[model samples]
Target: MIVTSAPRTKQILREVWRPLALLFVWDVVVTVVYFVLPFRAPSLPLTLFGSVLALFLGFRSNSAYQRWWEGRGLWGLMINASRNLARAARNFLPDGEAVDLKRTIVLRQIAYVHALRCQLRRQSPDQEVLRFLSRGEADFALARTNVANGIVDGTGRRIELARSKGWIDTIQQSSMERVLIDIANAQGGMERLKNTPLPVQYRLVPTLFTHIFCVLLPIGLVETLGVATPLGSTVAGLMFLAALAIGDDLVDPFANTVHDLPLNAMCRTIEIDLLQSIGDPAPDPAAPDKQGVLW
Candidate 1:
């Protein structure tokens, strides 16, 4: 995610330059046709059209931002649940064989967060997840279609085993299980956002109308603006186009784009906190890159 106060001008230009150039060229052609041919600028209801288009773009932008925010909220839930589960494992589970079990649970919580991050981004978790698990256990978890869910199931079994061995009482087991359920709910919400896209009409209609409005902008304005129509029309067209772009950028919060949630940084945070809970040497928190982005 971009952590800067404002995104760089270079980055904004890089994203929109192609469409901006096309709009400029189209505006110029419309202006030239008005002057060279015996054509009359149509009295298009540009103000009314612009108002309706703004409404459409506004609704789409709001919906996209809500999806982005929901994804962020889900990750926050996961982070807190991870820390709680690790803390419970360290405090509630008794020592002896349970000491090793406590360590296992803590490390596996870290693994689970990283695995969930990878699963959201549609990447392999092998490199980030395996180091935290035993070879046999990692193999078993990775063999499943949903690796993160598999890890959560394994953790639940371990918690139950501790209860059976009298390392933790039934009440303690139930509390930790509640945290796991929260984690699972958060993951399910994230998967729902990632798998289900915005309605096709929301995406398709606004884009089509935005481009069509831009194409007709100069033709409608050429009568009064004359040679200045290209400049005026291009600027107006860009506003609508940029609004359209914002919705697309924010629609998928887990696409691994610069606009996405800082999942990698957030996973590392869980790792550091969980490791420290068990008196292990934890790594430093993740820092943004030179571009002011965390991934």
Candidate 2:
């Protein structure tokens, strides 16, 4: 995600420059046509159109931002659930045989988060996930269609094993299982967001209306503004264009884009906390790039 307080002007210009340039050229052409021809000035109800268009853009932006925030909230839930599971395993499991089992469970929790991150991004988890698991276990998890869910299932079975061996009592096992359920619920929410998208009308209608307004902007204002029609119309149209871009950029939070959530950084955070809890050496915290983007 972009960690900067605000987006750089260069980036914004880059995204909109092509269309803005076209609009500027179109505005100039319209102004020239109006002055050269002896045609009557077209009177479009621009005020009414602008008001209705603003409402549509506003709704679209709000809906997209809600989806983005929900995705981040779900990840927050997963992070807490992961920590709780690791803490429970470290404390509840007995010493002796359970020592190795505790370490395995903690590491696997790290693997599970990474796998879920990769899964949400539609990436292969082989690099981020395999190193944390035993050869047999890794094969078992990777063989499944949903590698992250498989890891959670394996962890559940391991917890049950610890209970059967008397490493943890039934009550303690139940507590750990509750944490796993929370993790599952968070994963489900993320999946739903990634798979489902904002309705087509929300995406298509605002954009179409915005462009229509822009094309008609200079025509409607040419008689009043004269030579200044291009400048005034383009500026007003640019606002609506930028508003449309905001909704598009934020609609898919899981996408591998600067506007999307920093899933990689978040996964590394879980790794660091869980590893350090078990006295293992963990990687340093993730830092943003020179441009202040965290990935």
Candidate 3:
């Protein structure tokens, strides 16, 4: 996720460089056209068109940002639920069974977080995930098509075993079940966001309008500015392109881009918190150098 800091003007400028280059080329082309063809100055209608295009770009960007924020919030809930579920398991189980069963459940929950992260990023569940489960259990999960679901299933089985052994009462079992349900719901919400895309028609509308405005900008300025028509057109083009690119950048929140939610960091956080709660030695933190280097 983007850190809350003062705006990075240098980073924003670097991101806009490509559009700026394109704008320069566009201005040159417009200047040549103005001299070679019978072009007239822009009309009032063209200025209004540019305004409408700007509004469309703004709206699209705002909508994409909303989706990205909502996805991040859902993962926040998952982190809380995982910790709570482990606490409940430890608290409600019988003293004799509590240590082992609680540890097992806690580790499984950690595995679930890692598995979900891998699934969302379309990567394989690695050895880090296996470290959280028993050899047999890990092998079983590795054989499954959905590692996240497999982890949840293992947790449910452990819960059932605890109940059968009289380690937990019916009420405690039910509570644990509810927590697992919440985890599943959180997973489903994320999948929904990952799978569903913004409507194509809506996406196309801004690009079409922006391009139209860019094309007509030179004609409008040429009559008034002469050779400077290209310069004016380039400036206008860069502005429109910046708006469009920003909107495009936000359309995919789950991507492993700098602009995306820090899923790997979040999963590591869940691991550290859950393992610490169960008295296990915490793993060393991953390198923080690339924490915010996504595109």
Candidate 4:
């Protein structure tokens, strides 16, 4: 989603600033209380709490990143599946109907990609998808609740028609069906990732721990650091908050943010590549400035 490297530093800083501000406020409060009150140094238990909190934050961040990476990888498999399906259609269809059937099936595959992208983003399927289907077909597809499913249904109809017309053998039809099944499975996997989220209770636990650790850090350092307890506390708080905020930011991969997978771009790629493979004119490449940086 986010394209250039130039914006990441600014983005991370913006994401980290809110928690850092809280940390600074906490530090100031602790410093003032240290001088005003007859408070002794924090005990060894406080130090251990801070260490454990840091480790917990690290683990949470890693888990969030893993989910994000896994989601992207699943979409990568979808792209490959779509391409392979088009190639198989081109290769297996009878010679007389090869060109037309190849173009039709490949275009339908492209439409499926676009529809799925829109579905994941929770956007309406647009006119762009209509370009791949006939007017009656497009209107019929629009009647369905799930545009992606409609695309798959249309693909199956076309394959069945081709078989009835003697354009492909039963064995070839089965092969194509297998490819379609793979595409369906890939879509299912993506939907699984999109619908199921990390448990809220699980997320909240580490968050509470991080805050508690930040609160106790000043007391732990007060004896040795004295007036510099605020600085030490601020440092520890910033580190903890950085980990938490980053983890929070990476947990959702299909929320249609700039940080999420470039599904639109990937769909366009499938469309152009499949068309080119069948001797059709390729669509214009997307603008260089708009290209996304893949993780």
Q: Considering every candidate listed, which one attains the maximal lDDT?
A: 2
lDDT of 2 by residue, 139-171 (tens): 778989999999999999999999998889999
Which window of 10 residues has the lowest lDDT sum in candidate 1?
7-16
How high a TM-score does candidate 2 get? 0.97
Per-residue accuracy of model 4 over 43-144 as CA lDDT, tens digit each: 758667867777877888888888789877878888888888888888888657456777888888887888888888788875767877777767656789
Q: Which residue pairs of candidate 4 clash?
A: 2-258
Quote the lDDT for 262 in model 4. Answer: 69
lDDT of each: 0.91, 0.92, 0.80, 0.78
The window of 10 residues in a row where model 3 has the poorest summed lDDT is 286-295
Q: Any residue pairs clashing in model 3, and if so which?
A: 1-262, 42-220, 257-294, 258-294, 258-295
All candidates' TM-scores?
0.98, 0.97, 0.89, 0.89
Checking candidate 1 for backbone clashes, the offending pairs are: none
lDDT of 3 by residue, 218-289 (tens): 767777778987777787787787788777767777877667888877888888888888778887654444
True-structure Cα RMSD, model 2: 1.1
Error of 3 at 63 (Å): 1.5
Q: Least accurate stretch of 10 residues (summed lDDT) in model 2? A: 6-15
